[model samples]
Structures are given as structure tokens and as C-alpha cells.
Target: MAPSSDAAADGEPSGDVMTYHLKAEHELRIEVDFDRQVTVKLLSGDAEIFGCELPKGGAKTLSGVKCAIFTWHAAQIQIVGKPDACYEAEASAAMRSYLNLHTALEERRKAAVTTTSPTTKGPRVLVVGNTDAGKSTVCKILCSYACRADAMHGGVAAAAGHDHWVPVFVDLDVGQNSVTPPGTICAVPVDAPVDPVDGWPGEAPLVYYFGHASPGENAAHYKALVESMARVLAQRETDDVLARAAGLVVNTMGWTDGLGYDLLLHAISALSIDIVAVIDHDKLTAQLKAHVGSQGGDVQVVKLPKSGGVVTRDTNFRKRARDRMIRSYFYGSRSELNPCASAIDASSFKVFRVGGGARAPNTALPLGATSRMDPLRVAPLPMTRDLERCVLGVLHGDNAALGDADVLSKPCAGIVCVTEVDASRGKVHILQPSPGSLPSKLLLSGTMRWND
Candidate 1:
């Protein structure tokens, strides 16, 4: 609902500040332009952004984002600076369903605490839907809810020989990842509420470089990466009882047709996902249900409604968001990071691209059969001027004896961008976020590029 003329007049042309009074179960959604900033402060009562509780009287400065400030009870909020759009919405229905689902998952976690069966595990939930359906928002809400539960009952759980509830958030959406930068898939343990401004923390995240915005660019490689992430998660759950009980909340890309659909099924099986939450998409829900029924597995497919507060972003907006994400990795979201720029000998390390090599010649193939390239092939790329402005994933572990298989399965320590390739000097100048030497000599290349 638009603020009345009286409310708009009080601040619009004067101080450029506006006050919004929201009733219970209502939300104020605002979309801040990429070039602007908006400061949000909770004036009175209780409210939260996504699932993170907003600090009373504290201001959160946000830019280039579209978010909702939801209040479970009546509240007053103040906004400074003009956003592209702002409105109030009644979000009781969608929020209620989300809370109910969280409650059900919580019950399972409680049961897992006392269960002796080795086969028993917490809810391995997967969220799937079309583009702009609020899949990532749902993931954040669930993770935050789980973390809040842990904060309240962690001491009790610890007393009973259980660790704090730390839900693993697996993000398979390379286009707009939650934890890491774009063109990467990662899983991070969430034990605290995700900050509305800063998002998920970067502490000890298991990251893999997928090298492209969409999985369709290399479906085989993407599936392989998914399997690798699942393997690591399985091992973690087996070793930690609390983590096993706390379970996982997986976020996937918005692609949900053809190859996208096939990849979803593969992820469900590889991750042993038990709960498939489909948001506001009946066709996807029905397809998943039928497939699950035919396979006769323990997977539960549930339909969820998308929040009305979600604003649809155009292609240009998404591109700008991706660019900002990459930039934030080096400069920090608030320009608090001082990325080191240094030059290293080209021969000191190696760069490799996966699955883009040339196919075998027709003469080498059998008659009447076509030659096809191996999508998993590891091809070494030469250091040259062409590598300038390219983003590279710094692979972890021993690069001394890396092989094709290791390249596909190995996780990255971090990422760097090639600023300049000095061919005459045989040096590669790179921009690194931290002021440390490269962890390994193995670097992976993708199609992502950044100039600044």
C-alpha cells in the first residue's frame, strides 16, 4: 500500500526521509537502485529482514538490493534516502507456510538428537522453482530460522551430548550464489543469523569453481561438481552428530526445464534430498512428484507459495548484480577490503580450462559416426594477453601433482583476477583479495571476466 499523501508530504521534498507504520504480519518492500543507498531503521516494535531480526534503533545501510522488512507485530520503520520503489504488503499467508515448514523440520531435528540408528539423519531439503520465484529468499529464511533455534537451545543440546545446530547451506546456483561470488558453487555451515546487509559469512566455505553463470554451459561438469559437494557434505554429517541432525537447505539455479530438470533430479539423488520444496510452480511440482513416486524413494515434494513482496528483476538488473558480487569479492561490499596487486612469473603456476577442448578428428572416428568433444577433458591454457581481465579460481591442495580428476573434484581456496599479462617479462599481474601468497599453483579458468 502506498503511503498516504500526508505521510509522503512530511518528508518527500524536505528531509528525504519517510516513516512507514506496518500492522502485524505485514511487510515493507523496497528496491534500492544500483546507484543509490537506503538506510533502514526499526523505530519501534519487532521486525526482521528475511529471517534476521532487525536491531532496534540501529540503522542498516543497503544498496543495490530489493528486500522486505517483515514485522510479526505492529511496528514503525524509518527509511532515509529515496529508493526506486517502496510499498507495504500483507505477507501473512506465505510467511505462515514458511514458519510451518520450519517447525516440521525442527521436530525432525529434535527426534534425531535421541535416535541411535546410524541411518537416521536430519532433513536434507532442496528448494526448486523458476526464475524470480524467491528460491534464495526461502533458503535464507529456513537457514536463519534454524540458526535462531540453535541460539535459543544450544546450551540444552550441549548438555545432552549434542553440538550446536549448524545447518549446512548448499548453493548450486552459480549465477547468483549466496555465499561466494558468481560462477562458483559452495556450501557453508550456518550457525548464526545471516546479516540483512552482509549476507552469509565466508569462514571455511567449501567452494567449487563452475566457471560459468549457467549450468547449461557445461552440464556434465556441473553435475560432477554437484556430486563432489554431496560427497564432502556426507562425510561431514557422518563425523558430526549435530550437523547430521541439523541437516541441509540447498538452493538451486532458477533453470527448471530440459537439462535443468535433469540436473535437478541428479542433485536430488546425489545429495539424498528428502524434502523437495517447490515454490509457486505447479508444473515443476507435478513433474517432481511423479518422478519421486515412480522411483518410490523417501523424497517428499511440497508446494510453497511465492511471497507477493518479491520484486521481479530484469536481465540488466541481474547482470549488474552479478558484476557487483564479483566486485565485492575484491573491494569488499562496503569498500573495506584492500586487495593486493602483485606480479608473478608465468611459469611458476599452471592454468587449466575444463571440457572446452577440440573434439577428435573425423578421420580418427569410425565411419558414419560423428566426433564429439569430452566435456570433462582438462586442457591447459597458455599464459598470454588473452588471459587479461579473466577471473580465475585458485584451486586448493597440492598443485604439484594435479591431474584431470583432481581438477574436477578439488575445491578452490579463493579467486583472483588477471589484471595484466606481461608477455615480454613473462609475468602475470593479478588482483588478490587477501595479502597472502597463492595457496596453490593450480588455477582454474572460467568465462567470467572483471575489469576493475
Candidate 2:
């Protein structure tokens, strides 16, 4: 059905509300304008937007949501916001290309089963692009389509008592990670369709904390985490038939210049990516083509169009997004989690910084010699005032004598946000995931600090 526009009256003051009625098997697609916001609510009947289920009588506010399609068997929705543009299209052409890619992978997966050596794997795709280029959206679409295909083929695989059907999703974008909380790189198995709106559910993904919001904060640390994740994924693919057949779809950060480009190359090499999908950047696409060709490897570089509906976010918006991610971690997206708040003695804990607060230039250090300070050094904190309002990573390792490099390499059990710090009393107030004492007293600090 066509959308009907109405000016807000009485209780509704925005005056930009539009209502749409959808029949069975119909969809209403929307593309919010650049730098604008949209609020969508299910008015009646059963409806869902993306993978997230809309509350029966609640509304969801979307900021910088580029393009979203709401589908339902029979339902009505009231959208009280203006969009840059909105249209009804069955599917974009880029989606068709993605499907073709999936088809090719499926053929490879089947061929691998017939080969004498079952070590042959499907395509390992790495999606890279600048900010707001719809990298995440493309990853979701690819993952969802792959999951659907797996479901169709699962019955036969199940009859054989082989259950390795789900594809693996590696979230390397710590800035806006979909599988786990922010400041973490995760690897999750996707056996079912991903919620388009909510992305991946908060699954217990294999996580490694980078302890910073941006890659530029500690490039060495970020690259180290990437290598660690790559090693884990490689081992899984080797050991698990399903994972091997499914391969990996790695979603990366939007940093495509200078050190960002260097980090990207590091990831590409470490993951041994077979396909590099560059979204809407000619320079980056060309660079990857040359780099991969120069390396004498059979890596395919394909260019994908950026959706017109992608919204560009400013600095403030990104900060808010980070804050929301942290909040969602402790409280959950629907406020379903009840985290515990506790106070502890500051003297009992030791806070360490990773990568030694970024590296200095080679010129700054003496020739043929490095700085005395180590990049992974985990020096002790004096329980000073700077500890207040900072987010500290709860280390997974129990060894208190672990060196700085060892501590930086270890994954975190969870995170705690410091609320207050009292030097005289040696008491530190923190918001933690559970009550009682923390898992470990070896807390690692980074440049990331949160107020709420």
C-alpha cells in the first residue's frame, strides 16, 4: 500500500507523521535523509523491521539509519519523522550481486565435500569501506542470505549427522561491533537470519578487548588483536567441517587512510582473505587490487556501491553511539539486564595501560635502539584521580605476575566503569556486570572513558 502522510495534531507535535498500511506479503521500504532521524512504531497487527521484533505498543527511534525495509504478513505502522527519501523496491542490484557470490560459494562448498581432501574451504570475504558506506548493512545481508541458504540445506546435512552448517561472522570493527559490545573484536557463528534492526543478538561471541574506541588510539594493540582473532578463526576453520565450508565474513573499520590503511593491509594478510569487497571507494579498491596482485596471491577485489540511504554521522553522534553500546552492554538493549554496582579498595587492584599510550616515531628514539618503555608494558597505577570515570577491562587471565605484553594479549572477562575514586580511603566505586567481587583484580585501562 502507498504511504499516507499526515500533519501531527494534539499530542503529536512533530507534525511529520506518516502512516502506512501493508497487506499480507507486502513491505514498506524507507530511506532516511542524510544527517536526519526517524522514529518507527508498529501501530497494529504483526510486523517486524529488519531482524528486530517491534514491541506491540512501543516505538523505536533510529538515528542515522540509512535505509530500512519493514515487512509483515499484515500490519500497519506509524512513522513520525521525515526521511531524506523513501521508495518501494523489491531489492537493490547490489543485493543481487551478493546473492550471486553466495551461489558461487555454495558450489565450492559442495565441491569440497566430493574432493579426496576435505580441507578445501569456501570464500573468505572481507568487507571494507569508509564510514556510512553501508559496510555493516552489506555484511548483514550477506550473513542473512547465507544463513537462509544453510537452513534450506540443513535437513540433508542433519540426516547425515553432520551439523556444521552455520557461517562464521568475524566483527573486526571495534568502533561499531555488531556481535559484541564496543571496544571488542568478536567471532560469532551465524546459523540463523540476523535481525536487520538489532543486528546480531548479544551472543557469547569469542571476544578480545582492544581497550580503546578508535584504532588510531593504539595501532599496534589493534593489529595484535586482529592477528589473535585471525589465529583463532584459522584454527576453527581447520577443525570444524561446518565452519570450514561456511568460511568467514569479516566486517572491518572505516579507517582507510594513512595508518588506517596500514592496519587494513595487516588484517588482509593476517586473515589470508580470498575476496576483498571495497565499498564505494575507487582509490581504496585500486590500492587493494595492486597490493594483492603485488603480493602474488589469488585475491579478488570487487567494488560495491554505497547505498544512497546511508547516513553520515558527526563526532557527537559517534560519541553517543559509543555510549549507547556501553550502556547496552550492562543494561541490554531492552533494559533486561540488572547489573550490580559495588565498591572496592583501590589498593587491591592494579590498572595497566596497553601499548604504552601509543608508539613514538622511529626518529624520536635513538638509532638502532628502542625506547625504554615497552608498548605492552603493564605498569602499576598509583590509584590517582585520573582513574575516575574511566572504563577498565576485567582481565580473563588469573596470573597476577603476567607481563604487560601477556596482559595486553589476554581477552577480558568483562568491563567495569569507574564511578568514583577516593585516594585517601583507597575505595573505588564501579558499575559491574554482577554482584559480589569481580572476576579478577588485574584491570587494564585505556584511552576510553565513559561518564554514564
**Best lDDT goes to which candidate?**
1
Candidate 2 positional error at 275, Å? 1.0
Tell me the spans in candidate 1 whose CA falls farther than 4 Å from its real position: 1-15, 150-156, 159-164, 357-372
TM-score for predicted model 1 compared with the true structure: 0.94
lDDT of 1 by residue, 45-109 (tens): 99999899998988898899999999998888888778888889999999999999999999888
Per-residue lDDT over 1-452 for candidate 2, one digit per residue giving the tens place of the 0 to 100 score:
78888777566538488888777645566755335667777888776553335666577666545555545366777878777666543434555565576677677666554445666777788999998788887777677666656432434356545544467888888888877667888888876667645568556677887777788887777888788778878888777656676778889999999988998899888988888999999999999999988999988999887755466777886777788778878887656889888889987888887755656667798789776655655667777888888888887777777876677667777889998887788889999977888888888787678877
lDDT of 1 at 452: 92
Question: Against the unseen true structure, what C-alpha lDDT does each candidate score?
Answer: 0.88, 0.74
Q: Which structure among the candidates has the greatest TM-score? A: 1
TM-scores for all candidates: the values are 0.94, 0.83
In candidate 2 the C-alpha lDDT for residue 251 amounts to 92
Clashes of each: 0, 3
